[model samples]
Target chain A: MKMLFKGTEAIAEAAIRAGCRLYFGYPITPQSELTEYMSRRLPEVNGTFLQAESEVATVNMMYGASCTGRRVMTSTSSPGFSLMMEGISYMAGAQLPAVFVNVVRGGPGLGDIQPAQSDYFQATKGGGHGDYRMIVLAPHTIQEAVDLMNLAFDLADKYRMLVTILADGMLGQMMEPVEFHEMRDLRDMPQKEWALTGASDHKPRKVTSFDIDPYELEKMNLRYQATYKKVEENEVRYEEINTKDADIIVAAYGTMARIVKTTIRMAKEEGIKVGLFRPITLWPFPYKRLNELADTVKNVLTVEMSYGQMLEDVKLGVNGKANTPFYGRSAGVVPTPTEVLEAIKKIMVGDLNGR
Target chain B: MVDKAVDKVIARMPKSLSGKEFTYCPGCHHGIVHRLIAEVIDELGIAGKTLLVAPVGCSVFAYEFFDLDGTVAAHGRAPAVATGMKRALPDRIVFTYQGDGDLASIGTAEIVHAANRGENITTIFINNAVYGMTGGQMAPTTLLGQKTTTTPYGRTVKANGYPIRMSEMLSTLEGSAYIERVMVTTPQNTIKAKRAIKKAFETQIKGLGFSMVEVLSTCPTNWGMTPIEASKWLEENMTKQFPLGVYVDKTKGGN
Candidate 1:
């Protein structure tokens, strides 16, 4: 039940267990292991695994599979993910249930293959040309990655929307103990009446993003907005560590969140009264919870691998109730727990030089 | 006068067609290609289990015309999309209807890789030598010395690359089971083109590897010619550049 596995491998296995029978992806660093694992294992399970020609094809493949209401997913790094933007927008516009795993690396233009949280905006915000939102789940540990991969399919099917598992190069390549969940059979899953299977017993169905008429397009956008509002209301997830009795809260997610946890413990040992606030669901962000935490904290220190991308969200969450400062390392430079602790200490001492 | 004998139904619209009028320009060969595919699907009794992947050109609204289940794919990504559809539901017959710009230009990688993988799907390629939907623009299949919006001075080999022979190129891949280049300019050629489409569909139905039928079509509006003149022009000039006939036929023997 428990085994040492790389985060990418664990996510692949978790996908298999979650009844994801179709895997379409292009190989990118840190996430190639996931695609390679699928290529080997999917056949054994009678599932479809295709190494697509490119990230563009990979996402369109997901779109096709998702049109059949089947559980499908694709994984890529930043540059590859960028290539998939158009397809992702199509999937979102069509309201297809699919999963995307971004083993994020440094970028602006193929910056580096090392881990970075530079894609926070691309993942949470609309990366492609559309007024659409995808459910984004950021996991800090390999085990959490496995768990979230299992849940992503269900949430995607539930909302009939795309779900993104936003991890980083470090989490994807690092090995950790992960307990596998129970295997699910695709046969037991509910059928999607809207799928484009065939016109055997019913009329044919069409999966498309084009509503040429402006009124129909606007109506579709409104429905999508309503669905996203519902997701924000019900699906916000996060974790609060030592925030109950702390003066300073560190807001982070994914790999940065793991480092922030360590910093929280180190600062607590030094009696700095610093805690961690990690957003598990980055899109349906835990803004309300962060607001509640801000009410008790003196200041919020946001840590990230990029140059303060998520800092804007943290500041918005704090809503002028608490002073928010940011400390970040850009272009694939990951900060150590000591460095984060020093940043937290600086914030506590009112010397917000990094801000 | 004796009552006229009841006229027999010489031909009727195939049930696979939804009776929706095509959105293609007048004299567009897409209408003919759509009818041929529908007839094939009907003849094979696969209409109930067929899925068409419509591409992003003039035939982008193909789903509206085909009664079968369908999905509209991004520009040049129909083959990739059809690959997924066929792989996921192997029992279903999948096909992609694409234009020259969509397949030969934007989606070159997808088509080549899908054919190389021997994915069990059919592709109906319409090579009009110019982009249709976005007005007249040079396509990858545009013949040398042909003029278009992008090639106002004519498509010269020095500035623009030579036209791609997709059928011949795809036939070179070992995975492709059947590959043919046919034109719909004349009634005789239309019949030949229909046979090629049916054969490509049959190749897929038999679970053969990649199959494709590239139909050399006419773009009257873009060509700045009347419908009749465009057809004659395609028969004259296009055929010389992109020859017709079966380039590869795995069932008949070899390429």
Candidate 2:
């Protein structure tokens, strides 16, 4: 049905329609709407929805429900997501598949419940432990919020990877039009060989990563690294605009990326050739694609809702091929499209003019 | 007929066990509790289908001894991990083997709420009144007047404090279906411990609710005593502080 839904609600609805049977979560600001949405909708489809005592409990519940091969999910914000780190680490170690939605807020420690991209490092750099990686999707708008959540579940199950849907408070709180889908049946899905549901007489199944020998653990970590490489090779995803002949390129993600889209359009109108590269998958990051763009663009300016977190990746992608600069706003202040356009103008002409 | 019954009862244990002898110190009650859990798994014939969650204590390497599907959890977080395991495979038998330090100290919240929610799982709690895994240290169950490395000059009532009665504490919750406190001081008590373990498993099989069996175990190495002396101490001092017998058994009231 066509209806205006908040980004958090849309993501929750998309998860519900993706045959998700269990939703465990603790309420937090900028994302409580998602839990509220699930609380109302999950029961209608005979699904389980639990408001866990805390974020820690919610994630563990997600771990438990996911073990049964049920499509399970949890939603929380920055501080809540921090509490869930231990569970996330266990999920990765167990090779369990589940979706986690982090509606990002400013934080070193509960900085504010407002929108922030400060979790860039935590999400993309293996937030928990034990040499593991999770599939992280950065959604820029309400539509992408719904779309990425479904894709998150799909990637999680297919790769036995923990998938994270990361959006900041802006997208989570903003309302936009979205079309919902009827839930799909998981019965026809490929059988999960690693799950401990039950061992038939045919063969016994086991799920663990407790080998104590250093060499064995090294080999297990090597396998995980190889799988991460494959994901990086096969799953690098992004959106590009006006890159055919551009001197300056702007890189951003999530809420900032969406704002940069409009900024790029305005930059083009001003006769200063600037393009936009918005990464969709923050982990298995679109480095190769950005590297290719770096060869063509004169300078790359990375913008974000936090202080220059993603700029480091932009520089890594460019690798001295292009001049990389950053503009950011932290502590709950979201930069406008005009602010980004102005920053681009200053970078193009303010210093090292036309270099 | 007596020989036949005896033969059936004295059968060999399951092959799913890791076969490595346990690393627990002599006079430690972990071995007795482990044997009891193994016997219960044997009797139920669910060892093949059971997924055991081991805690980080002296028994962290329990996965090495139990011949079944087992995973080791972070200290005190075994219940949290078991919660996931049980939810994932509701049909499979899932149980967490944890210690007093691992459960009552850092993981108290997870265990309490999981029980309060009536999660259909089994928790085998080994209360040794001290932390045996990490040198001799005072545990939440460490009795007043009991001394350890962390509690010098004995655990004072006003200072180091009284021992926690987990079985009594957990039995007060409405969602808990079966809560029993058993002692493994002798072979006769060991048999009763096995029965408690079996009942906790049966509760899950019947989809009753949360079940826990807290075993009063000895830690002779940590207590600076021989294995026999530790068992004797458990009989004299430990039993008086943490009494044996079921604190709460609600299987008849359960589904």
Candidate 3:
């Protein structure tokens, strides 16, 4: 059965279906509806929803919930996500599993509440301090958002690492048709042996991020590196659209990918052979696939809502094989399909060739 | 041969304690406070169900000494972490151990709001006059006219703000079910401190509300005083600034 839902509400309901019973978050724009939805729905399912005092506290609360070996999540926008960096780092260091949703807004400082993909670097790279990586999934539609929310919890638990849903404000606020999956049984999930359930059934456990001894810390870092390597090898995902026989290919993710899809359609009508490569998993970015596509495509156009953030990755993936051009709008500006198509045309016509 | 009569235990570590030596300095009150909490947990028979949220000050590694499921929280965020733990596992007993720097300064917002929300958790706050872990820096509880590394010439009211009486301040909040300031300066005072710790946990077990025991602890190493003198200094000076008493006890009114 198909149900229409805002991107924010879909993610919230998906989390419930995914057996995430504990949620801790502070109110932030573009994502407040997610929190508000959880507040009303969580209790009906006997789940806990706590609106924390601040983003700092909310993330720490997530850390606490995560330590109990429970599925937990929080959603916020850009500025609030910045406040959660420290807690995110702590969770990473402790090797706890939790999900974070970033309904990204404009950046640098207190940017407007409109949609922007400027947090690409902060999300794909470690937003917090230290050498750590989160599994970042970018969903273009509300339906994809629902499906990814279910997968996110499993991936977080599978790797014992943080997982992030990177969505733009437009995707968060937009309404679309979504199909909710069946509820997952909490008992069917894998047991967390390291969790601090209690001391009665087993030896006392201490979940901590502190390691004073340099050698011990190094060993922990090596373990994390090994885990991330496995994730990179096993979890890279992306969607390919008409790249099999195309002269120009656009590289985008999330909302930008959706717009690029329209750009491809428009370009096709004009006899412009343009395709798209949409990265579903943004962190272990579909670099290998893009490298292959770079071999075949004549040129690549990187589209975003920021000043060429993901373009860096595109350039790396293209690896001098194809001419890579960039187009973006910053500070809460959403690029329309015509504008994106024009940029593609510019790249295809060699109008932006040398520079 | 008469079997050597097993002297009914003269002294032994509490069952809740892991039997590990604490790393605190000789005169540090953290050892005393840890013992009191362990004893309370043991007596209440909740050691098996207790979860401790350790803080990032001197007691940052407190999980090592307690034989209970615990997690070491980030600096000054123990209350927030504990709030999450208790809320998630409502059947389990959760508590936080924090210091002056961790609780009164960086964690002020967490503690205040946790209290306001009346989270069903207990807090054991150790308020030394200075930041012991960072080497004698002034703390939010530092007494005026008291000299320390940060306040070399003496903490002056003109320059620095007056010491915060957290127990008194927290008592004003409606969500706080129990708030008391106790010290372990003497044997009698240690007993009173243990009693206060017990009552704090009892409040939580009863599902009352937020209960906290603010311990007026001594830091001999930081204060540049002998272990003996630190006790006297705490009793003479610290207690005057932070009066030793129960500011709020909701159970007293049978609430």
Candidate 4:
């Protein structure tokens, strides 16, 4: 049976079910519920939950736990997550596996505590220094958010890279029915041998991102790029609704996609052929699939809580094969289903991207 | 080969100290402190299970110098990292080696919180009064009226703040089990520094709480002084601002 669960709490429970026994977090809006849930739930399972002094501390703490070959995670909001950029880069450089959740909010510096996707670029791009890529998971529903927890941890471990759940205040605060899967018994899985348990009976080892030699560092970077190529090849996920005979397709992710789902139903009821293409992995981006889907549609309207951040990707994917128009609400504004439907109606009547 | 009576193995390079040659600048105390930590690890027979958290600076390559599992943390973030490691593996001995800028400045909140929580970990803080890796910028521990690259005309109280006494400041926290200020300028002080490091580790082994040893060090290259002059400068000027003594010792009930 499914039960009503808040998005933030469901995400927390899902991470716990995914064999994450260690968590370090600092409280922030929208996502504070997840931190609070972990603070209580972790102890019940005999897991470690440390409220770090700051996001910087939390990320390093997660890195430390990751070094031990233990599954660890942390959650924060936009401003707080910005402080973790350096640690994120370090984790990527060191090839450490850890999960980070950013329930994004308005940004560019202390943007209010409202939902926004302005961090789309920051999440998919290497927010920190260096040529590193983080596997970003964007979930449109509470159930999907919960379901992706396992994949998030597995991908991090599989790629030996950082995996982040890109959420926002809208989805973080919304409540919906969610059914949890069985908890994973980590004992049944293979342990990471490269973990920093100790050097007893073996040679000493180290896990570090620092290499003074530029040549050696370049080699490591090349290896990371290779791994990213493999990830791109293997981990592209997306959802297509009503695209079999649709004239217009809506592109979005996370909270905005959920809102677009409502718009999809409203549009279909009005006998308008509108489809939705929601990206699950925002970094790998499902660009190939999106391009294929865009080939079938006449126009693709990209919607977001930010001013067309993901629109850039949609435009590239469509490659002018379809009209790639954008509709978004910025600075804590929640674009309603009606607003999105109106935008779709405008697209049906005229090309919004007629540049 | 000499006869058994003709020679005695009074001392040798510590087994835990790896074969890596010292990379620190001349007159720097990091190499000696590294040996001290290795010697203590050897003494305790924990070279196999100790996890070292290296900080960002000249000693950022501490993982290469020690014969154990180790990792380098971002600047001033080592204490927090060690907290996670120790918490994750309760049986493992976790420690951080950090510099003044890393610990006393950028990482102040992390270190204080780690100490306040009584995290079962150890810290070896290197206070060289100047940011060694960043071209000798004035550190939080840089003495007032001391000239650094950033403070070209000698630090003034009106502009740059006075040297921060981290050991004294941290010892005041209730969760700290051990906190000491030591220097490695002289042989005697080096011995004392090693003793402090060992006691800090013992405190962790005893499951007491957070333990730290803040070692006053020299930066000859950055200080524009010869090795000998650097040692003298540390002894004469650094000690004046940061006293040498134990500030906290919960193992002995209190200090």
Candidate maximizing lDDT:
3
Clashing pairs in 2: A64-B84, A67-B88, A68-B88, B16-B67, B17-B66, B17-B67, B76-B102
How does each model score on lDDT?
A: 0.90, 0.82, 0.92, 0.91
Model 3 chain B weakest 10-residue run by lDDT: B1-10
Report the lDDT tens digits of candidate 4 across residue range B3-73. 46566677778998887887898789999999999999999998888999999988988889888899999
- Considering only the true interface residues, what is the Cα RMSD of candidate 3 after superposition? 0.6
- Give the CAPRI rating of model 3: high
Which wins on lDDT, candidate 2 or candidate 3?
A: 3
Candidate 4 positional error at A3, Å: 2.5
Off by over 4 Å in 4: A350-355, B1-7, B253-255
Cα error, residue B26 of model 1, in Å, equals: 2.0
Give per-candidate clash totals. Answer: 0, 7, 0, 0
lDDT (Cα, 0-100) at A194 in candidate 2: 66
- What CAPRI-style quality would you assign to candidate 1? medium
Residue-level lDDT of model 2, residues B186-209, one tens digit each, is 788888888888999998998888
| Cα deviation of A156, candidate 4, in Å | 0.8
All candidates: DockQ: 0.79, 0.49, 0.86, 0.85
Off by over 4 Å in 2: A202-204, A350-355, B1-10, B14-18
lDDT by residue for model 3 over A126-179, one digit each (tens)?
789999999999999999999999999999999999999999899999999889
- List fnat per candidate, in order: 0.76, 0.44, 0.82, 0.88
Query: Candidate 1: lDDT over CA atoms?
Result: 0.90
Relative to the unseen true structure, what is the Cα RMSD of model 3?
A: 2.1
Recovery fraction of native interface contacts for candidate 3: 0.82
